[model samples]
Target: MSVIGQAEGIEHGTVRGYKQHRYRQIPACDACKKALRDDRAAARRGERPERAKPQRTSRRKAAEELDAATEATPVLLPVPPPPQLPDRPEIGVPIEGADLEIGDVIVFLGNHHRIDRFEPYTGSLRAELGEGTRVACAGTWGMTVGPTSTVRILPRPRRDAR
Candidate 1:
């Protein structure tokens, strides 16, 4: 009975067209109904192939129930934080002409920073991590633990080409 299936100039009289109408939950037009009746009559007289019955399902009801359940119960899952980069076991190695230094790349507290130089102080080493941040301590040689952060350097890291 919907006006959508009753376009003035559109043809909806074929079996294919009627099936499409049923798919959209639209009522078949009078022309399509007459075509179906004539086809059945011909099949009874053995004049044509029998028409196939359209498949029926309760998908609409299930979809409606799903919509209602989602509306009644909101999703309360927490969003996980972004992944952090794993720390490097050996930040640097001792080159023939250089003191123990850091690698080209260093990951700290889930962040990466470049280290081109070293600033040593007594029992520990200091590396100016970024613009205004000066974090002290290198691998296992000694670690500097403060109220804010901790840095450690491995005593004997393999000499690698960094």
Candidate 2:
């Protein structure tokens, strides 16, 4: 029997005690199914389906245009050099035996710090340094400052430095 359709005038058959319907009803091949799907899709889209066109661009033309634009633009002025940083003042504070008060500025290990609070009982001083400042000493938080710690008093920043 033909696998694709009913053989001759035969509409159905029985094989192994099982009834076999026509190919259209019982089974359709891959090609038939794909064609039916494409027809339906085209009907829904209201047009014959066509393959997509490849998108293409000319790299050489684009590069030439960019080069032309770069050449056409004029350089009006040379860029100025960056301004120099003002000289910092020399200030020091020896944590070992130095009197400290709130709002006092000191430099520690080349970084500037301001004493924000002092605990007489614990002999701990809380100081705030410039944001992003890095220091080598540890325990700068609570009970951190010790007599052995030497801090330099930072010079006031020039008005321009602000």
Candidate 3:
């Protein structure tokens, strides 16, 4: 039966209208009704009871339990093995002037920033990879196949020529 927007901030007219329209309206909580009944009973007896205090748990025991739980579980994961490069000499050799295409898995040999990721060349040429990420090429190079051969580059999609 609690309302809003009146002298007590409850909409009195709306409450009255709702009560008139509905046969069984204005639903109230059981605990609130029980509290009202208890108040009435206490008033009739002319006795008021003090509120009950909450129980406290040991902080040291709680801390010990939390520490035991944290110790039981592992926080860090196991590190994985590094990526492997192709064994062939021709494909493994770094080309002086040749820019890597999409699908070309090149092992970085230069000492600049020193990371061991296989640089897969795509048609787009622009690699949207984060810095310092290491990758390995799965395909091996044959004597007949060059760096841009279908055997080595056919696994991934290539960008359309402009």
Query: Which candidate, 1 or 3, would have the higher TM-score against the true structure?
Result: 1
Report the error of model 2 at residue 114, Å.
1.0
User: All models: lDDT?
Assistant: 0.44, 0.41, 0.35
Which predicted model would earn the best TM-score? 1
For model 1 the local lDDT of residue 122 reads: 37
Ranking by lDDT: 1, 2, 3
Residue-level lDDT for 132 in candidate 1: 26
Residue-level lDDT tens digits of model 3 in 94-117: 321123333454443321121222
With candidate 2 superimposed using the best TM-score fit, by how many Å does residue 16's alpha carbon deviate from the native? 99
Clashes of 1: 7
> How many residue-pair clashes does candidate 3 contain?
10
For each candidate in turn, give its C-alpha RMSD to the true structure in angstroms. Answer: 31.1, 36.6, 31.7
Candidate 2 residue lDDT tens string, 125-151: 334422222223223732244333434
lDDT of 1 by residue, 131-150 (tens): 22332334333222232232
- Compared to the true structure, candidate 1 yields what TM-score? 0.24
Looking at model 2, the pairs that clash are 91-152, 91-153, 92-152, 92-153, 93-151, 96-147, 107-152
All candidates: TM-score:
0.24, 0.23, 0.16
Model 2 Cα RMSD, 1 decimal = 36.6
